[model samples]
Target: MIVTEIEEFSEIRVRARAYLCFLLQRYIPNYVPEPSLDNIINALKILKKELPQAEAFYILDKKGMQIIDAISNNSEYRRGKGINRSMRAYYYRAVREKRCILTDPYPSLLSHNLTVTASYPVYDDNKQLAFIICVDISLKDLLKLFHPSSIDSYFGHFTKISYSFFSLALLIVAILLLMKGVGSFFIMAFELRHINIKEIFESTILITLSLAIFDLVKTLFEEEVLGRHKKREASDIHKTMIRFLGSIVIALSIEALMLVFKFAIIDPQKIMFAVYLIGAVTLLLFGLSFYLKSISNIKEEE
Candidate 1:
């Protein structure tokens, strides 16, 4: 959630900065009052039309006193006039650096709602600071502009919810498998009144399968629901695969070992099957090792 918020904020800031720069370059001195107050108000009107999310537009002189309030509402403009904003971070940063800046979301004094301020510094003919243009945007409107598509947002939310339910279902199945394994072992022990080698081998196989299911559930929950193993980088993908596949390799090796013992003592004729299982396990381990080595080499090259 934090990562998502950061990403959204970054996108909003970048867009606001670019748009402010465009406005400054194209609609200059007119907005600087060198042309006329009418020109400045017209420029502000054009900006408001282009960016509907912009709640208000104001031009502040180098002294940080409101020079012109071009907001649609006259009463609101009158109320905002002559306000000093020299101490505000957004105003100070833009004037000091002579650049455009987008401030983090802050509560608006008038509306008491979250707002982001985009400030652009205007320069006079001598390249001295002339005026600072400010645009007030609400956080809700900023998000709408950032996302743009309602369908994408809804689909993304649905995907997260579905993944959560899928992880929960896998967890329930794992628990049931574990219970089945334990119940089978108890039933056999009580009925036979003896712990025979064959019965022990069967119980072990059941328990191993239950364990494998549990491992899969854990991996799914961590990767999908908790997001503990997100694949952002090549190394992240490699680590996730290693953890998930390592469990499977261990389970397969155990099953193969059990098969070998069963064939050697109870059924010698089935020894070839055990040999084949061992060969498969060996090949899997070799492939996994090669993949890990390749990942390490790639990281070194980087």
Candidate 2:
């Protein structure tokens, strides 16, 4: 999965670079020494028709101040005049390096969507930097342009469907377990008249296990099958693991406590085994908690 995502990103970057070069070649020759309003308007029209994905086009002076704002007619957002972008990495890199560059994805100030900026340095007759031409491309559009084949899309759909089926199966199992636990409790309470504490303890463990299984299945359905999450990041993985482990720890602790109580009342000699079990589970819980915390801290630093 990681390798596939990396390859897709690399391919998109190459395609975006090529697209930016084509625009630079076609538009640079139309530059006038002292561009008038008509020149800017005509250039904007040509760019709008040629590059449909480009959100906006900018002509920035040597100092990285907007000289011409040829906002795309199809775009709902527009930029104000004379906005200084000298400190922006894209502006600095294009101006200093004198090369066409594609920027990493960032939130667009206009529409607040993820966007990538392709910048090219425009030089005048004296071979000095005259202006920087920038084209804004929405990340959504860029990804769609280089989207995977239908086979991959179909495979993804299949995976989600499989997850949904698996989750439904788990839900059915959980419900059956819950009904069994309830039946066991009723039998102990009414039929047996609560003579055996062990039976009650067993019923409680069954109920807890059933609830835990149901919780896990619900989480899987929401996160995987239903696509409730946008993407699974490091934090999401960490949280999922922590929740799963915590549930197990809680269930084990409850079972151990019940064992200890039963042993204390019936056979005190076997209480040592329950003590050891509780100690081991407690140690594991502490270790897992510490490990998760350290991992979370490291990811935050990164």
Specify the highest-lDDT model's number.
2
List lDDT for all candidates, in order: 0.70, 0.73
Tens-digit lDDT string for candidate 2 (46-110): 87778787788777778989876557755455554688999887799997788888887777876
- Kindly report the root-mean-square deviation of model 2 from the true structure over all alpha carbons: 8.8
Q: Residue 90, candidate 2: how far off, in angstroms?
A: 2.4
Clashing pairs in 2: none
* lDDT of model number 2: 0.73
Global fold similarity of model 2 (TM-score): 0.51
lDDT per residue (tens digit) for residues 78-163 in model 1: 35778888888779988778787888887787567777888877775567777778888776667666655211255445655787
